[model samples]
Target: DPPLPRDVWLASTEVFLARGSAGSSDGLTLVAKGGHNGEHHNHNDVGSFLVAVDGVPVIVDAGRPTYTAATFGPDRYDIWTMQSAWHNVPVVRGRTQPAGRDATARGATAEIGDDASTFTADLAAAYPDAGLDHWRRRARLDRVAGRVEIDDAWRFADDAPTGDDTLLHLLVAGDVRLETGGARVIPEGGARPVRLRWPEDVAATAEVRHLDDPMLTEVWGGHLTRLALPLASRTQLQVTVELDTPIEDSP
Candidate 1:
């Protein structure tokens, strides 16, 4: 309440990433993820994310699919939901991600700060079986900009052929609409909608699928929705999911 300052604003640490949060009740929270594909219990998601708005999980993790005795067997990865294609990540060079320690997410780092925070991953090792030479993914939780930004850049091995299917995915319990350049998704609780966009220069198609899995059925009470992108690439690409309703902007 100083006269030198025309206005006074409060500051709070809203980012919860590598650094632990100093508990508060300001009602804003954002988390950045870091992990490799080969981690025994982490599953096949190498570059995925979990986002919440007003404490409501908007972009969710497609958690444990139904179980069978074979689910514990060597063939566990054969389960469709166990693959990377079903998570909030991308598929490289037409290959669904493999499950193994050798298939990994490398050099994962996260930086938390007052203005914004960032998390990055070197995904090259995660796609070795897909003929990849190098792959990197960067994600930013911009508290100032009120959106998360993602940039994925990759290259194929010298002898690798041109691609057929290169794409990304996001799993949700929300309703999704395919639009001109991206998609509009209403969060699971039917609160505000989130707009996920791809650049106009990049060619991408968005579609939602209804799944009738035995496990997803028992959990969510119905078929789940997955947003998929079949992409046309050029060694680099960017996709951004904008939270149309950022907490700071809401009443």
Candidate 2:
């Protein structure tokens, strides 16, 4: 048999199925069946193939895109795995131009297991003005993936206007046991009324509340509130803490 065309080599799948080009559009369709005769619950065997018309070969399917990208090379082609529902597979598309941008925003069908930061950075580079709040929110959600226990400690500047109720939202994505402890206070008021708003999706396993003495009475007071959130997949834990004291006027 004569050597397959470059396009054929880049676009064809090993699975024996009906493969053909759509003609007008630069897309290929591949139909996979369980057996050679294309019978036996074959409805679940269906999948779509997408190829970018550019000189390079970029393909998307139901599996991981990294495998395709590596096989094709970054210079020659790219692949994306589309999110699917039931037997109908959806191949997500992300703009390959503009260099770097989050694949999710552009409808990336593939998921990055461990390189969330790098992926987010790439998306940011691709779309300079792309608001990263969504990515940031997702990153925070991704952190609580495996174990049931979660321990996070960080300091946030309480610089919001006093008397103006402000809410800090913390979204936890996975199921986890949480323990929170911190100090926050207003220099003027000894202790401001701060409340913890647990995410409706998550369960509050335990909570420990404590108020520490004002560290800097001259500048601003600080108080801390901590709680634990237990959640499951697709479950979100939102903690809304409020600061209810008037911010001291600057001298």
Candidate 3:
């Protein structure tokens, strides 16, 4: 018998980036995924993110029901939960990433640290059908600063026509307040709040879509909010979501 190493090793999913655990750092964690849409149990989602704190899910995935005969069949994308529009990603024009292995992200890089982490993925190939020439998403998590930042940069093909057609989606539970250039989301049971700050100079709008499904309402209560970040008037965009810890009252 051989002596075992003190620290256990882990393998990669080849498509995701993460930090902390459900309860680590007082229940704080950050996750970002980049991959092809043709994966098993796949959702047409690339360059998406999930964040949780204090065992509370702030930004999350949508209602996924029990699987049946049709879950894995050709009708997978028919489910709302498995569609790109329902995910936490930017929508280019009125198009969503296609359902194919060739619809993938590229040049993925991650820099992990004790107090900070950064991830970058090129998502242009994921939306070739949209006439996308180049698209990139970068995520930066600052534990000390209690913030998660997302920067999306994209451009259309040289010969393709250009128009401002873009929207960014962020799904959350609990109380929410939508402002002109940003939004505030507080998780249920009164956990820390997440503050979203986007470019105000660009024309933007926010809307909430309330879910009516029984199971979904059991978790998220009413609905989720999607941010329509103006993408037609520019070639690059940046969005930041800051975590605001509740102020404890002194006895």
Candidate 4:
């Protein structure tokens, strides 16, 4: 099999897709987005991402539910799936990202290469009321290393809430099992399991949401799981994701 084309960066959309070559047993792909919160039919999910191993989405996006009368109303964000806390984003100071074009990403950059693909952006503007001076999120897919690393570093304003106030979330279409310093995501179907490792200081937890809505169930089957990591009382957090190598690639 030939190598896949290099990673893609959509500058206008502020979305990046990074992946290993097609022939690589480590068929890992990461899709990350950084755009304004006020997109049409949008979720308050700037700096959100998804992970797929061997073409199966493990860390995923819980797609929008069926449109209701209130779907486009002022209460649109009241829906859990429309909130940043439920998406693969950080909730800072207990505040989800605000919805508006004013709430946008800044200083976004991407570098596509054979060794690694990287996308980085400052997300502080996406949380207008979160009292953040800067929230820098870096998503890097290292083809040589066979892993994807998400690094988030932030600086809080003086008045921002103190004590473990930052929580990162990743929604998954899989079974999640907690381990020593991280968790393993075994995607339903026949996809290889993916490991999500975090810093020792971060506390990892999982939540399962059963999908009763037909719109959601049709795509995700019965349910989805959310892996939540509450950062230590600190300014930075890094989550590394690794996909198991195929048997043929083993020594």
Residue-pair clash count for candidate 1: 0
Which tens-of-lDDT digit does each residue in 118-147 have in candidate 1?
777778787777777777877766666666
Best-first order by lDDT: 4, 3, 1, 2
TM-score of 3: 0.83
lDDT of 2 by residue, 60-127 (tens): 12232223344434432222112122111111122121222122222112222331110111112222
In TM-score terms, which candidate is top?
Answer: 4
**Sorted on TM-score, highest at the top, how do the candidates line up?**
4, 3, 1, 2
Better of 3 and 4 by TM-score: 4
Q: How far is candidate 2 from the true structure (C-alpha RMSD, Å)?
A: 24.8
User: Residue pairs in steric clash, candidate 4?
Assistant: none
Candidate 2 error regions (>4 Å) = 1-135, 138-189, 207-225, 243-251
Error of 3 at 15 (Å): 4.3
TM-score each candidate. Answer: 0.77, 0.19, 0.83, 0.91
lDDT of 3 by residue, 1-251 (tens): 33322111122444444444322444445677777788877888888877776557777787575676677887888887888887888777778877889988787777777577777788888777677778889887776676777888877776454476666777766677777677777788667777778877765565677788777888877877665666666777787777766646899
Highest-lDDT candidate: 4
- Candidate 1: regions farther than 4 A off: 1-34, 159-162, 201-221, 245-251
Count of clashing pairs, candidate 2: 26
